[model samples]
Target: MMLPTDPAQNLAKLIRCPSVTPAEGGALAVLEDMLKPLGFAVARPTFSEAGTPDIENLYARRAGDGPHLMFAGHTDVVPVGDEAAWKHPPFAAEIANGEMYGRGAVDMKGGIACFVAALARHVEETGGPSGSVSLLITGDEEGPAINGTAKLLQWASARGEAWDACLLGEPTNPERLGDMVKVGRRGSLSATLTVLGRQGHAAYPHLADNPVRGLMTLVDALLDPPFDAGTERFQPTNLEVTSIDVGNPATNVIAARASAAFNVRFNDTWTVESLQAEIHNRLDTASRRRKYRKDRKEPVEFELAWRDNPSHVFLTHDDKLIGTLARSVEAVTGMHPALSTSGGTSDARYIKDYCPVVEFGLVGQTMHMVDERVQLADLETLTQIYRRFIGDWFGSR
Candidate 1:
């Protein structure tokens, strides 16, 4: 039996599967085939929610007596926008100028591929590590996250599965392979704000209230007086207004309603509940301001609806896990990696509840771009880094 020791070969097979969001696209099947040959016991579980599409997830365990290590990632890729614009077919896994072109190549099917190759090489050369290892992969990361990592973690915990540490294979580097390793992530919270008013002719200003004016006031309140000064270990919280909509097509009429959607990437300064309270307070105070409605005497009538569950902030404190992975990266790439917490939220937010988790993978300069590609050299370097981390982590334990 041949081992899947080559990172490029493993990645090509994965990229060929068009496993776009909510679609298996044969990606999980291919992964199962690769893991089975390495003596892993794999189980494919399908999870469902009311409005979300049923998603398939994989949990494969190669058991041993020592502390368990979990490798987590997703096989799904975002849809290719304008497939004709790609230099190479998105699913063809074409190689040109030493870089492989495909969807999910760097964000992040490539990460999964290198980790699998590292494990394969370890099994072939050293009969594997002394500890157990498992891969918790989900197909729903790129889609509605309702049935993805959060629920998967609960299901696994129900079955008595536990881990000492986790290394999530998310693309963490900004410019080069060893540029950064993510040790923490800011929280994410999203909400929609709607202001209600009466519609009337634009010329009849006194007969109707313009909700757009009120919306501007509320949005200004949210943006001003920055959330907080920079924290010691985390950046200051920031909020972005993603969309503002009124749905009015007429030029001479005032719309009856105006709404805006906003998301906040917050640090440890506030919890979801406290943040919600602060936002409510800001809106409450702003709604009564007469600056937007000088003639009106009443507060702005508005509704605030929070979208989905909020992702809480987290930071890993495990020295062994962080130090071992950092050393492995520096040893292979000859550059010390920065321990950062600067990117957007990921499935690591969910994994952190179970055990300490850190993220490291390939350089992510081209992830999610029209021509998503990864250098063949980076693949080998990342594989070596992961392989080294695996051996050292288990040996230290």
Candidate 2:
């Protein structure tokens, strides 16, 4: 059988699969088909939880005795919001004007395709690396990540497979290939603050308490003081009031309750517990401030509830891992990629607990856009970088 040497072809096959979040959609099947030919033992496992949908994941390994390296990514792409807005069909894998158009073209699948090609080249040329290479791919990344990498890693660990280092193909480049590599990510936490008050006619101001006023006060307290000065590796913490709701439509009625939802992207200065406590303290102080009016029956009565699993801030300090990827990117693109921690959360957060992980991938100029695509040249260049990094990683260590 002829081996798949062209990364572009690999990516096209992947893009053709409409594997939107939590859907198998044949994306994993295509990946397994490619990996099996390259001597990787591939397995697709399904994990389930009571509330969340069952998730399918892929774990492929080329076993060896040296320092193991893992490549992690997601096969599922975000929804292609509007089909008509795209130049070509979202899943057609059409190449026009030197770029391939598809949903996951750059955000991920392109990066994964390049890594597969690089690995294939290495295996074909050298038979195999001194060390092993494994891939941890999940379908739930674009969903509520409940039963994905978190579960896959535990399964791998149970089978005695742990990695020395990991590389996540998460479209880290902001403008161009090699412009950036994510070394860390800021933590994320969110909460819903509900303020309860008496509902009555707006004309009868004395009979009704306006919760909107109280909710606004709480929001102001949370935003007035900066969380902290920006850290060396992380930007300053930021909180945004994502939503404010009273659900009241009538002009003459005061809302019985008003709620506001806020999310914080915090730096390493605070942990999940400390940050939650700080937010509560701020709310407590603001609600009781008498700043609203002395005639109100009592301070704003509000309740705070923390949402989903909080992502903790983290930094990868492994010199060899960081240096290898940095040099590989520089060698290929002739640009020094900035080691940054300025981005939203990713599966990398879960991978960090098991091994040192970093992210570097194709230019993200089109990720999740109406016509998501990747330049064919960028695909080849990324493959070369991955090949070099693989050689440098196992060759040196």
Candidate 3:
């Protein structure tokens, strides 16, 4: 069947796939069919790890000689919370009130649709650019991320495919079509702390050590002094205690151990190693000050474990890439875009390691929500923006 070249129809077809994380749902197949006509040589690699389910990702390129540019996004969508909550079906791709409704419509099957349209138009108009363009679409962006961009990039590198720069089609704009582009993201880390004590009757204070008291004191020490004043482009490092538990339900019995979990969203002032060391110092110092345990003469007993790899902080600094995308947005929408680094992380975190990357896409008001949809006009406008960006990026070089 011949696919529709119209951006809206193409997006509706993608939305119909129901490509919730780790599932192809025929979304990648649709993309392969679309790209074949555009002369891109497409490769679908299904990457896997021990614990994570295998994910299918696409790497397609139009063979050429000049600077290589890549556009990256996910075909996956988060699950629809309660299907009955939607005014229209989640995968129906229904149009009403001047908007197209469905999952991934705005957060970003719409992005994929627009970019394909832009590329199709660019190829038709200029007979292809001096350089090459490629697409990196993954099916695991919303999952554990074990088998997604991190592995796909490695696979591509093994085949000698390297990119000069990349543009991520995440929903970076908040209020309008051309209001923002994400330039960086703050780092994140999580840890668990457990403090041990003696269990005894509540009334017999002299016989038992109260771990709750020690845990509260340690938590206070970490929170009282702020990590740092805000950095130039990022907010200050902030710590949040997600949970505290003793698991004891009795009114008169003391618990044996208290556990607490906390997360930190930090800025450039600290690296993953330095921040971890600081946490250990504070905990050890707090433990030392409270050493005379009734009769034992020892500090509070505790254990700490770092849960996951710290998300490394980074900023995109390529002038041509950032400037071209910004200019494209302005030219299409007549609005200057803001280069921001103040949101949660995305697949771009991994892509940044390979090449300078930035994110620009549709307004994100309805993403991952009931009746998720996009205004038809916005899709066309975004396509125009990408079209202009593709022309400018390769034309200038």
The candidate maximizing lDDT is: 1
Task: Show pairs that collide, candidate 2.
Answer: none
The lDDT for every candidate, in the order shown, is: 0.94, 0.92, 0.88
TM-score per candidate, in order? 0.98, 0.98, 0.94
Q: Model 1, range 32-92, lDDT digits (tens) per residue?
A: 9999999899988999989889999999999998999999999999999999999999999
Residue 348, candidate 2: C-alpha displacement in angstroms: 0.7
For model 2, the stretches where C-alpha displacement exceeds 4 angstroms are none
CA lDDT for candidate 3: 0.88
* TM-score-best of 2 and 3: 2
For every candidate in turn, the CA RMSD to the true structure comes to 1.1, 1.2, 2.3
Identify the runs in model 3 with alpha carbons over 4 angstroms from their true place. Answer: 1-4, 289-297
State residue 233's C-alpha deviation in candidate 2, in Å: 0.9
- Between candidates 1 and 3, which one is better according to lDDT? 1
- Model 1 residue runs over 4 Å out of place are none
